[model samples]
Target: METLYDSIRDKTRVFERTGVASFSETENGVQVLTDNGKRVEGSILVGADGISSTIRLPAKYRALVGTSRNQFVENPKLPFLARGHMHNVYYEGISGFCVQGVQGLVFWCLFFKEEAWPDPRPASKFTDADCESVITKYGHLRLGTHYTFSDLWQSRVNASMTVMEEGMIEAPWNRGRVVLLGDSVHKLLPLLRRSVSQLPSREELAEAFARYEAKQRPRANICISMSNLAMRFETQDSWWLRLARRLVPSIPEGAWMPFFVEYITSAPRLDFLARESPVGRAHDLKSR
Candidate 1:
């Protein structure tokens, strides 16, 4: 993250200590106002500010619903249990829980289905009592043989609960000279570990945004659907679903290895820049 910040600062003109208050499109370009009442004009405005992006708010992009929380704890045995010092460990349950080891601390999350917390309030509106109540309900579950959710909750120094909104801004991501990018354009379930790729070069901005939407939208939608399906399979109490889940892990690895390899190899790729020699197309052509 620091490397990304440094690269942006070194390569681009940056505004420091300035917050965007609002934006408007003009005949020549886009006009922006800073929180302190200063006006700045530019040919293009890129909104990469993340899920609560001020830019996306004006564009009518909103979160429908989700509940998430992150907590940290000390787990000395984690390095040994996770070979090669694997950082992320996810456990499937009625809802999914994840433990990520980073910088000598274990960061974990509890994801609840929308129905679990249907209040529709912003995550910030949830109080410590609310957080504690939810944690207590699931605290008895074991993360592994030795660690339980209770252990992490008791040791937590800080935590937050948030609603994960899922949606996409309809095409023509740019209106006049103002455009959107990253979480501003689309948001997905966090467990998927997906994100919008790099922006196109300035010279190709217009064409690039169009291509980005066309290429990314289909794959993003597929991932969102898969995530929703996985959540339901893991969280729902339906007898058939639970039975299927139990049986899935019991299947021999050899039974699914070929299909798994095919799926991974055929996963989508983003084409932000032209390639001198594309490698995957010939294999795809031969298979076809």
Candidate 2:
């Protein structure tokens, strides 16, 4: 993210500490008035402002996310502390994913089911006490095979909790010269990338936005459903679910290949970027 920012900062005029006060469609483009009494004009407006997006979305889960000083880096002898791989650990009613990254930090998120919130849900800010409650409850869960959530929490460098919105907005994502993306339109529990390219006139932009939403909506829904299912599998206390969880690690790799293939092939690559040649059995399955 820092690399991308550095590359683009020279070309991009970024306004900091100011938010959209209001916006209107101009004859040739969109005009945005900022809270600081500044006006900015652009060919079109794209809202990528995250879960607390100015654009509306419904939320169904709350998550606590944090970064910890990597214990593996501190110890250097910890087993299975593989960088760039996610370790998902679960306890009843909570699902946690932790990753030891190459950057010498351990990032983690604990997501749990919550009552659904309507569009424009009230602002929720979780206190340090709330974070402590989480740590007190589920901190014993193992991250990978060696480290526990308690290990991460105790060594925490930073932490915050926020409500996670789910599902796509029911209203049109684009209006006149404006469009929305990411959590502004569809908010998935897990990480998903959303992108739009090209600049066009109002009519063409509207058509493009419609096409983009139509194609991406189903894919976003599937991702949301899968995330929800995963949360349920990790959190539910039902007997059959507990049995299934016990059996999951023993499930054969072949049983998962088809889903893996579909996920890989469904990824959309930018036309302007270089394409890699497809290889391996997944490519063979796709070709077939």
lDDT of each: 0.54, 0.69
Highest lDDT model number? 2
Model 2 poorest ten-residue lDDT run: 188-197
Give all TM-scores, in the order shown: 0.55, 0.63
lDDT of 1 at 117: 50
Please provide, for model 1 over 59-101, each residue's C-alpha lDDT reduced to its tens digit, 9 standing for 90 to 100. 2111112121222245433432242232222334344444444
Model 2 Cα shift for residue 211 (angstroms): 1.9
Model 2, position 77, has a per-residue lDDT of 56
Candidate 2: tens digits of C-alpha lDDT, residues 190-288? 222333544566887787778877777777877777766665676653567767877989989899978967876776545455657655565456567
**In candidate 1, how many Å is residue 47 off?**
2.0
Which residue pairs collide, candidate 2? none
